[model samples]
Target: MRDQEPAPVERATRRLSTKETAELLGVKPETVYAYVSRGQLSSRRGQGGRGSTFDAAEVEALARRNRRESTPGSSPDELSVRTRITLIDEDRYYFRGVDATQLAARHTYEEVAEWLWTGTLRPGARFTAPKESLAAARRAVSALPEHSSPVDRLRVAAVAAATADPLRYDLSEQSVLGAARALIPTLATAPPLLRATYTDGAPIARRLWGRLSHKEPDEASLRVLDMALALLVDHDLAASTLAVRVASSARAHTYAAVSAGLGVLEGPLHGAASGLAHRMLVDVLDRGSAGLVVADELRAGRRVPGLGHRLYKGEDPRAQALFAALEELPAAHAALAAARDVVATTARHTDLHANVDLALAVLTTSHGMPAEAGETIFAVARTAGWIAHALEEYGERPLRMRPTGHYVGVRPPQPLPTQTGRE
Candidate 1:
């Protein structure tokens, strides 16, 4: 009755610019361009040829494809060990089937150290010199420009070592493992930059990791360091690992791969927390009162830097292990001890646990090592895991992470202006 068949209401699918398309899809404009480059999207030019536009339907389909591709496996809650590393969402570190915290507490760091570098690296084995190829590595590091940060120093050293030894091209398992361990300490104490005014770097204290035996460093401190490394070693598909894997995908050598990982660590969000943790401890020590320190941090609207973890629901086992370990340190800072007590008592939850950061701060405070040492300590320890992971990635069939986009552009072309409508 109301206009019989009802007048057909024509609907025109709208077009969007690249920027608008990116916003709609929650991605960067460049990513959209990448999708276009890969032929995953389709676009057409306006009749006047101002700009190309894409069909909204095609764009939606591409977005759907991306969602399907990114969905996790069937058992999302279950953990999967990918490559050499095993991830339980965001809270564990494993080195070649070994639990990091267990090794850190039960065995010397050296044993854990050797295991990462070489899957076969284990404790109670006689140390063997591998031709001092790493010796040349020392000379390579000292030659970088003086302005390099610890990260750059590590990168430059890798490049230098890469140049000095022709043997790096060999990706044999034996060789990769050896490189992982040896380069660790080297990266920690690289040769001073050739051009800068800097103090001499520490020699790779070959026995330091060993000194963390149940005998010295107050078993408590070593425990803290161990837990810290275990927790810090890796995270699931973090920006850093993503960077490392990206490089690995190109079949870049291990050094380049590790170097790529370091690049991500150089960022403030990733590697700077160790520094922040160290400073927080220094503040507490300087204030000379742990209670005052916690109160001060709380008043300032700053949560204690090392007290909680993102994944552990406020009860980090590594932190628990470290707290137990801290009880055994030689002259551990009284303030840190007090702060730990304060945090346990006053925080929103009595359950707010100390994380690897606080644990590492305790270690550095007790050891009297340099303040920026945790980041380096972590970098060295994790190198083994990264290599192991890299090897695993290298062995897998390449997925070739190609970028794609949703095609969104201007309007369809308009006919050229006819003279007077063909008067």
Candidate 2:
């Protein structure tokens, strides 16, 4: 005997029309057809062939994947990437199951990076560079113009270091970690290693401070910088992290993957946000009123730069943590007041809240660093994150992030013999 057919209601519950599927996926009708074409969601013609109907379960799965893929602009809503390094919740960030805020407050950037690279936060984790790589990095930086930005110098140094390292082709876990360890210090422009007895062997943050500033290092400021770097070590899969992963998925070396990440970070909406925030802060400082500057910017149809985040509904935890650190220093008073004023004014006028970019701007300028220093900090700190993501992708199936384009161009070429003469 033939099997019984399911009831109409049951079938209706399991199926969705094209329009309904488009709404469910937050895409257009064309996108629904493309999904069907790509086999992401199965579809069949309706009775009498009027419209397309999609499997409801498949549409729902695609919706979930789209949501997961939507992050930080550069990552399009197509591929769902999985990572165990970091998780961004509504109000908190976790790095390898540990609260990033807690880790930021107490740990060095090296320790946080080690934790992200491996699941364990071993106290013995160290970041040191070989002498040959250091020389290559110095040569690369020396070759750049005097006006080159920190990130620019770092990028050149990265390429040079990669070229110099004979073992850079190794994709082994330990070998990759070793290259990462060697690469970061070079990128930071650390002074040449003399001897174990002569060097302070300070943490990454302190060494970075020395590289970026001419002023003598303050212990308190260095501590805050360490916290900032720790907090920024990883965040889910940011656009740059996704870029790094995409490169690593193709079996690219750690330096190559990081170079790809830096390319993404150079975008205005990504790593350059800190510098933009600094400009906004300077505007407030020059105008002598944070509220006035913010209101004027909004009136001019511009957003108060760095005042809000898409992911954080209230305040970004990184911002709050860095703000708390700022509050500890007397020198940060003006920057803190500007930040609070912008926050309060924006909150009164709109739903936005202060984010890490503003906090970073405040931290840098308040300490007498240039406005662009914030971008430098972000780039340096995020290098660790990109490397961690590259490592994660190296373990996955190679080239798995290659996404198929949904063709939306004109139809295929066809014979038009008679019409062609008229045209």
Maximum-TM-score candidate: 2
Ten-residue region with minimum lDDT total, candidate 1: 194-203
Worst 10 residues of 2 by lDDT: 190-199
The per-model lDDT (C-alpha) reads 0.60, 0.79
Per-residue lDDT for 368 in model 1? 67
lDDT of 2 by residue, 1-423 (tens): 989987766444577988888777765576576556546678788889999787788888777765554345555655667677888887888997889999888888888888888777768465778888878888877877777766687788889899889999988778899999988877765332222211335577766776655666578888898888888877777898888988987889999999898888888788888887888787887877787887788799977788777778889999999999989888888988887777887777588888899999888878777766777778878989998888766654455677768899878796665644554
lDDT of model 1, residue 155:
75
Enumerate residue pairs that collide in model 1.
35-404, 35-405, 46-413, 47-413, 47-414, 53-409, 53-410, 54-409, 220-325
Q: Which parts of model 1 have CA positions greater than 4 angstroms off?
A: 1-81, 89-98, 113-121, 125-136, 143-148, 191-236, 290-303, 333-335, 349-351, 403-423
**TM-score against native, each model:** 0.64, 0.77
How many clashing pairs per prediction, in order? 9, 0
